[model samples]
Target: MPANLTADFLKARNEFRAAKDRHDKLVALEKMLATIPKHKGTDHMQADIKRRIAKLKEETQGKSSHRKGPQLDHIEREGAGQVVLLGPPNSGKSSLLAALTNAHPEVAEYPYSTVLPLPGMMRFEDVPIQLVDLPPMSAEYSESWLYSLVRHADLCLLTLDGSLQAEELANTVEEIILLLEEHHIRLVRRKEITEEEMRVRDVPCRIVLTRGDLGDLASRVEELSDLFPVIVTSPIDRTGLDALREGVFVALDVIRVYTKLPGKPADMVEPYVLPVGSTALDAVRMVHRDFVDRLKYIRVWGSGRFDGQQVPSTHLLADRDIIEIHLS
Candidate 1:
């Protein structure tokens, strides 16, 4: 098989060749690693890039021995799931983050206003999901660490400026997609594991068209909806913000399972979040490892045929279902 290098990879390679300092070389190398195609043909190239990155990191750390501060390369996951925002500059990422989450990231009319990742918790009913606002993705401005954050995110929201004309908006979306692909991140609607796709991270994504109040977005929304679940929102008037929150929760594909004692009322607050299709046995294991072996059966509510109906350990749980573990 041929390596089949992409134009983006070649450009990054050239940047690496032209780099004057270790920092620039490291940045370029990160880009190269991200943009390089993932396949049997490029396996050797990938390994080489990894080796170079490891070496550059050691050198950079050695030179900055006194460097002290929080690490910017990673964000800790919180809430039920972590969702990272990605888009072109001035695409209303900060505005949307401020509107949807408690974090007050700087919202400016100028491009490149955001330089670091800021995270806030967004609540969808009783469940809270972590929403991270990342620096914009562009050829000249995006940081290499942003790609790493996206690769690890539980979900991705690709925001577009709804104020642009449909054609320009579409073009901006295309550019963002190309940049993400160059970095080996694939935005998918669902997790359909396959041999080829497994090589790269397939994070679920939702499209958010911000600045909905600025222009007519019906056409843009309709067109983009064909690609992914689309939500048109505006921080100015808070349009579609509610729907966006709900969409994020649904895109996570997780369910909230409540627990209760046999004689006590169900604990409605702080439900245990689990992936859809999880079983009662899984919940038992989460509660405690001891329960896994000592558990006799589970009584279910909400999804059960009747209230307090006894179910086997393997019984599947649904969202908002209440379970009471009965021990022998």
Candidate 2:
């Protein structure tokens, strides 16, 4: 027998939620509304979904003056996330990018080979995540634009050469942290609550040990644990590629949702990785204000009690769901 209506609904709902294309969300929303079963089992769900669909359409018609700006462009997920790679000269950022992604950045055994930022997409399970290699900075002084880029990134991957001693490595981390703090981009330890906590706030991060084969890499990672989470990887040894890929996704704060529909085959959609504090309204906003209006009912499938279960618009979403939304 085919999957139940709730299963199909959740699948499509998640697809729409994770959709990068605005129009694709509308299509998914329409399919969800059409395929969901009618009657008491889904009555309230159908009504609310319809209401949202209408609201989304009206909002798109320029009804709300509160929604106007360049921010619309910001409401997008072209890649996993905008992550900038930062560190001093010869920190192995460019080398790591060249190995992880197909970008052939200058990879000489020298300092400052990269004078400008080079962008490349690293695909994890076919989901393309952006990684930008920024120009190297020094502890004594950092360029203004370099600081700005790191500040704006959804996550920053700071590479530390394993060859540096414990004290030097700590100093380098402290310096970069200070630079980040100077620009109001502080890394918080979500695990700890303190006057100056190091939680993964709006922006999450991970330390990558480049040149992992070097003798001191492990020791340095151990020392840095007091500061931030670490991902020990070597583009040369290729020892931690898998872990690094997962780290990129985690730092991006995304979740994957598959799509299933009536009389349709299921497919894996892009990762709908929002920030830590994303809400259903935030998820809807990810699509467009129009869809938020027309959001009727979202039926979910896969994992947990909600698996193959239908819920109202106010329902929260889970990870790796097959969601379908029924709209008006």
Candidate 3:
């Protein structure tokens, strides 16, 4: 059986996932239960929702009975996905984050200007991705948070100084790679395998050539393409800003799926974020587990569809595809 789910249910799920407080989570769960389809297909999902609601209520009561000390935690990931900017000192990482987001990371020409993680939200079309600017990665210096930040990130934007001479750029990048390797991390193209290590973590990364507005720097950095896939940008001139936005979205391997009522149009305002190659059944399950057993089929209204064409539950979905689910 397939899960025939609705967009409203998915939105509530996101709210639950993103909620910072127990009260907010409880509110989101209640909305999720209300939005969930009342059908046999959703029986399991209904139970799961109720279970979560009960758990949250219990936790709320427990919280009122206990007081906790201040706790140190990593920057909470927000938006569609979390991405980090990593590079050597003076690599223009802060400038790039500042340009793309509202975050005021202290941009300076000298090294080690940023002392802590600075996070901001960047938008691609209507989708928001969390971008974090961390202290630079270098042979002599890197914050303790660098490893965890890169490891947990959905993608890493390797910011490089376009103004650096070719040889200097090569050395800087090589050192950065070695530093990552020491921490059991490796950067590679999606298909490339990491050299054997007890706990090697391979991260998907792309190069962002910053300061290209400087004399002939953009062209010089083009010579490094054999080194890695590169996106050139200049915060001063706003060059390649659009390309950077689109590149990050694609590199993250994410897609958005929209849902619709049987006879009404799909809700275009909000979408369910899923990885690429996600199927109709996968989407249904994400919307709510109960949709799994009762989902009869799905009708898609985008990309290769002839307007609301019926598709198998296993049909692969693309970004912006409008899906209408039927029940048994």
Tens digits of per-residue lDDT, candidate 3, 4-118, equal 5688987787677556577988999899899988887677777868987897797678753453642112567787888889998888999999999989988887889988888
- Of the candidates numbered 2 and 3, which has the greater lDDT value? 3
The global Cα lDDT (0 to 1) of model 3 is 0.81
Candidate 3 ranges beyond 4 A from true positions = 1-73, 191-198
Sort by TM-score, top down from the best: 1, 3, 2
Top of the candidates by lDDT: 1
Q: Which ten residues in a row have the lowest lDDT in candidate 2?
A: 191-200
Angstrom error of the Cα, residue 185, model 2: value is 2.6
For residue 100, give model 3's deviation from the true position in Å. Answer: 0.6
Clashes (candidate 1): 1
Q: For residues 1-328, what per-residue lDDT tens digits would candidate 2 score against the true structure? A: 2223576876666666555554666677777788777766566556656765776676566676576543321223348677778888888999889888878898878888887778888888857888888888786656666765665566778888877787888898898887777666676533222212112223456777777776557678889878878888788888687898888777666666555554465556554555444445555556457877887755667643745566655555556666665557
Query: lDDT for each of the candidates?
Result: 0.85, 0.68, 0.81
Q: Per model, how many backbone clashes are there?
A: 1, 37, 6
Per-residue alpha-carbon lDDT of candidate 1 for residues 1-328, written as tens digits (9 for 90 to 100)? 8777898987787567445467988999999999999999888778878987997898678865555886676686788888998998889999989988889999999999999999999999999999999999976778988898998788999988887787777777778777888888888888664434425668888889988888778998877777787899988999899999999999998999999998999999898888787788878866776988788889999888998999988789999999999877
TM-score for candidate 1? 0.79
